[model samples]
Each structure stands twice: as structure tokens, then as C-alpha cells.
Target: MTCTKIAYVVAGTISIFLGVLAFHVYEVYNQDDPDVFPHNLFFPLWFSMDWPSQRTYPFPDHIQYVDRQYYAEILRNPDYAQKLRDENAQYQILDRLFRLKIIRDKFGIPLTLTLDESDTFSMWVEPKYPTFHGIDVGIGKKDGRLYVLYNWHIHSVNLFEDINGMIADIGSQFDSMVCSDKPTVVDGDLVTIDLLLPSSLNDPNKVAEKCGDREYRMCVQGTYHLHNTSGSPVGVLGYTGVIDFTHLGINRGFRVKSLQLKTTENGKRVLYKLN
Candidate 1:
């Protein structure tokens, strides 16, 4: 190629490179210094945390659920020069907003639901004895009190029937607390249940024939808020008390069980009766 043509080509390439760099510099200069929250982003990004360890919350996978953590991590990632290329680093860009409806319904209405401000949507419960915690997880209530069951229990099941059976077995065989008859809540009706413990269940000295005489006593109590809908609804009740949990999984320690619940007419409402 001729010297003149070569020089012209080099000049054009250098100009194009300079223009790209100038645009980048201009963007950095004009960028707003974010304070606390961004003035550009007035929309609140909210999410419920799920802590299997109750700390070092694993950020939600959704962009909105983890926008702050994502962007902040992106900014904090510095070019590392250790042995070779950095391993624990990620590069990210903030260039989009996600918008969609949050669905927390099971089946459909007469069991359809609209989230109320007062209504419990989710929870991050830490047990009374934080140190003795089993696990913590995010729970969205589909029908009503189901959220309580899901949050409190860590058995790794989500089906309503599965949850119900787990509660029944846990109450009866483990905790000595029994669940009242099948829930009688109706659609849109808010029902509060004052569940009671079995008389001898919480006794510290209570012994079982199967235990070979290792007796431990602990109290079990729980109050569940049950709501029923025309659609089949299954919910949960959470409680805590003291007991020897040495046999926590073998039905040895304090736990929950289901009791046959009888309902009798009271004024115009039916109330639970446990025999």
C-alpha cells in the first residue's frame, strides 16, 4: 500500500478510538453521585430475605429482589492482581428495570386473594432461642395461616396436604401439641384459634414406654390465625415451648400432633372443641 493511504487509514482508526474514549469520559463526568438511594430511581426495591443460617442472606435471584446487592457488588469489584487474573469478581451493568405482578395465590377465587397492607405476606422469623435455631426461610402465604407453618417448619415440603400431614405427625408424636379438627375457616373470614396443649404432654417428667425411662418435660403452646375460602385452604400454626429435644427427629423431644377437633354452634359461629 502507498505511504499516503497507510497514513490516512491509521489516522481514521485513531480518531474512531479517541471518539469512543471521549464518550466514556463524558458519561463518567456527568454521572450523578448516588447518595443513599438514587435520585434517578425513585421506585423502591423491596424483598423478603431467606436465611438458611439466618445471616449472610442469600440474595434473591430476581433482578429487582437483588438490585442493590448486584449493583453495589459490581461497583466494589476491583481489578485484582494476585497470582494471575482475579477469580472472585464480576462485572455488571445497570441498564434496565423489571416490572411484573407478584403472584401469591393458590388455585383461584372464591379463593382468589388481594394483598392487604395488614395482611401477612411473608416473614423472617427468628425463634425465641436464636442460638438453637433450626433454619430460616422465606414464606409467602397462599391462603392464610399457611405462611406461619411454612416459615416455622423446615421439612422442605410445600404441598398443602404434605404440610398438613407433617404438622399432624409433629404435633402428636413430637411436641405433644395436637392440631384441632380440620380447619373450618371460610373465604374472607378471619378466624383466630387459641390452641391448647395436652394435659400431660408438657410435663417435664412425662415418660414414654418406648424411651426406656429418659423423661424430659417441656411446655408447648401455639395460636394460629386461620382464614378459609371457598377454595380448599390449608394453613399452619407456629408455637414454642421447652422440652428435651435430644430425640428431636425420633419423636422424642417437644413437638406437635393433631387432635380430633369437634365443632359446636356458638351463637351464629362454630367453635372448635378438642376432647
Candidate 2:
């Protein structure tokens, strides 16, 4: 996938990472015994919209028009609103996602939220997609029907060519997806692609190779297209690209030009370029 702002999703355990956040939730939940609280006080796995259940989180301070309808619906629903009560029911959501969808450097994106209780109350939202975990997928509105236009995972690649990226950004990085122009490519001559990566230094466990104790690593994925000319008839020989999963992906420049194919064996002349 092409590394864009769309890929940055908030995927993390809210308890520790977001601990400094609203302490009121903690104070209310732990008024009596800390042992009663779930070790992971987030990811409301028990209740789902599917089984007439509701998962609640903090209401955003701002008056966001984008998700006003969705919030209004939840606030109006008793099942949904009940979850916010202080231990009002047998099960409560430790954490929840009100409106968060982002995609980033293909790494460390919020992926899952699970419930711990045995309540029949199952909750749900909408058309969640695969390969969407690493993206910042959130709720929004479009023509009255609610939609999701969140950003997600970060990826990067550098190449000096003028072809539409096919393999790397094959599915997600099209013109309409990024609000950018589609690139054309010429299919002759050798092209070079370079890459750089970053680490979060959060891998204190030393289990992650790229993390290396970094708080985070910016992984990336991208492609560089190349094309041929009208007079040429030779296919491409071969090429290589640097693979780095640490930094977010980027395309410096994409240019389409006419090029002639080099003779391989039978003096065949092949060229590839934009139409």
C-alpha cells in the first residue's frame, strides 16, 4: 500500500499507553477494589453491537459535525448509553473507539478491541474491510449515509521514473484515493529506487528486529513505474529496489519518457511507455 496520512490508525492498549488520559474513568472504575478491574481496561470484548450491546468511550470535547449523527444515535440508545454508567451492569467496556480510523507506515496501527465479560450484549458498527487494520478507519457522513474516510498505515519508496505504481501501491494508491494525478511510465532502461526507515525505539523487549528498543518505527511500501516507447519492442531485463520497513513510504518524483530497449540476444527491440 502507498504510505499516506490515511494509514495512521490509533492502535494500542489504552490502559498503559493512554494512561495519562482521563483519570476520572480510572477513579470511577476503581472506587473500591483495583483487583476487580480487568488487567487490560480497554478493548471492550464482551459487548458488541451485534448482540444488542453497546461499547462506550469518552465523548469528544469538540462539536465535530463529521460524527455528530453517530454520537447522537449512540447517546439516544439505552443499551449504548448504559455502558457508560459506573459499573451499572455486569459488564463494561474497558476501552472503546468512538470515531478513530487512521493508516500509517504499515506498523503499530490499532487493530483489535475485545470484550472480557460474558454479557449477551454484542455491539457492531459498519462495513469493516480487510487490510484495513493498519489504516485509520473512522466513521463519517456522505450524502446522508454514514461513511468512513479515515487515514492509515505509513509506507515509503523512492524512485526516479514516470510509470503508474502497480505492484506496491496496486490496490489503494490510485488517483481518486489520494486526490493526486495518476503517473505514467516508460518501460525502457534501468531505474534506481532508494529507501530510508525510522524506528520507534519502543521495542524494549528486543523481540522486534526493526524496533531495536525504539518507541516506534515508520514502515513503508511503494512502487516506481517504468514504460517503453512506440518504436521499441524489447521487454525489460530486470531491476532491484531497497526494502526498508522502518520509515513511511514516499515517491519523490514520477516522470514518463520515451526510451529504446537494449538488444538482449536476437537483437530484439522492445520499449514500454505511457499511451
Candidate 3:
């Protein structure tokens, strides 16, 4: 072939190579794109402590804390970051309710009690004690009597079919509490406790045996809520609660299970398992 013809062939090959390279780059960028929500869709603007300048459109402080923590996790593993973000958005309204103390005072339960982690599972019984990590509390009025609702988020634990058993066990304890009338049961995919108290709430450990074992074991996610008779949400509370089972002779257990709550200074979320 002539020199000019050879040059023409080389140019064609280079053009095709550049086009393929550009397509690959576009694909990679699309895969990692952070705008999961549609542009026109309305997502509430939340303030972040990490981004204080956005104060004009600030997320609730609790939400800020959670967002920072989850986004940090995105840096390490982008696979589940969007899932976390979607869940966080659903939790924002509830977090604000607890943060502003609306639910606490409404039910005459203190905010400290809801966020308390010292009492393990006893918070379900003793109103004065702090709430366990996975439990969220709120009050609703039905038929002119005050009713308390307990929302528990059991996550990452291996309860399997035993989850229903554990919740039923917990429900039974609530049913035994001193009440003027029978406790109303509002069972769901998640656990919801509604008890009408005649006097002060009391502790029941009837299911202590089910708290942990080789067959049934679990921990709580940090965010949960309460709903009213019409199924309207009452409030949301966020806190980390992990139950240690090593003392119970369980070889596989979570030493430190951190959910939506901040788990690291750098903002990365973590779930530490001890086996």
C-alpha cells in the first residue's frame, strides 16, 4: 500500500480505540453516581454537623450524625451506601421527633430514658431506667387511656424463625404487666409493643432464656418509631444497642454491633463481630 493509505488506516484504528475508551469511562462514572434519587423528587433537606455552612437547610442533629457516619461507610464500600441513605431518609422525621423531646414529654417518659443503654433489656419494664439500644418508645391515646408503644429494630442477628418466637416472648412479658385492660397487640414484620398501664410499668423476665443461645441470637438497629391508632407515626428515636452473649457461652456473637449510631471518629459505620 502507498504511505498515505497506510496513514489513513492507522487514523481509523486510533479513532475507534478512543471511542471505546470514552464509553468505558462513562459506564464507570454512571455506576458510582451518588444521585440515587430523582432530580424532581422531594427529599427533605437535612443539616449535617460536618457541613455546618448548610445551616440554612440543616438536617436534624441526629440525622447529621447518622448521615456522616453512613456516608463515611460509602467511602469504604459503595455497594450498600445507597441503601443506608434511603433508610436514613425514612428515619429523619422520627429522629426529629425524639430530638425535640415531643414524644418524651407527651408520654411523660424522659428523653434520657429513651436513649439510655445501661439497662440492657430492662428498659422495656422500668420506665425510669434508660432505654436499650434497639428500643424506641412513644405514647398514644386510645379510648381515653394512655398506651405505650415499644418499637424494636432487630438487625443482622441470626434469629431466623426464632425472631417471631423472641418477639412473642417479649409480647407475653408485656401482657403480664399490671394493666386495667388487656394489652392491644399490633404485631408486624417489626416488633411493636402497646401496653396500657394501670400503674407504673414493671419488669418481666419470663423470656430471659430466649435472650441468647446458639439457635437464637440478635442485636438492634439504632433507629425506630411509634405510630398511633390511625397508623400515623408518633415519633422516632435513634440509639445504638448491642447485646453481648459471650457470657451465655455463645461462640458466635456480636461484640460491638453499631447500627445507625456513630461508630467511628472518621464517620465510617462498622459492625464488629466476636467469634
Ranking of candidates on TM-score, top first: 1, 3, 2
Per-residue alpha-carbon lDDT of candidate 3 for residues 24-113, written as tens digits (9 for 90 to 100): 444434544443222111111221221211112122222222233423543655443233323432343333334433234544332221
lDDT of 1 by residue, 107-181 (tens): 222222122233221111222111121222222223222221111221211224344444445434644444434
lDDT for each residue of candidate 2 in 134-242, tens digit (9 for 90 to 100): 2233333333343334333321112311222233234434534743223222255333221111242212222223322221221211111212232232233121111
Best by TM-score: 1
Model 2 quality (TM-score)? 0.16
Off by over 4 Å in 1: 1-215, 229-246, 250-252, 257-267
Q: In candidate 3, how many Å is residue 270 off? A: 32
Q: Which residues of candidate 3, in runs, are more than 4 Å off?
A: 1-167, 174-220, 223-275
The Cα RMSD of model 2 versus the native structure comes to 25.0
Q: Model 1 has how many clashing residue pairs?
A: 17
What candidate 2 gets wrong by more than 4 Å, as runs, is: 1-40, 44-208, 214-218, 225-275
Model 3 deviation from the true structure expressed as Cα RMSD, one decimal place? 25.3
TM-score of 1: 0.19
For each of the candidates, give the backbone clash count: 17, 96, 6
Candidate 2, residue 244: how far the Cα is off, in Å? 7.3
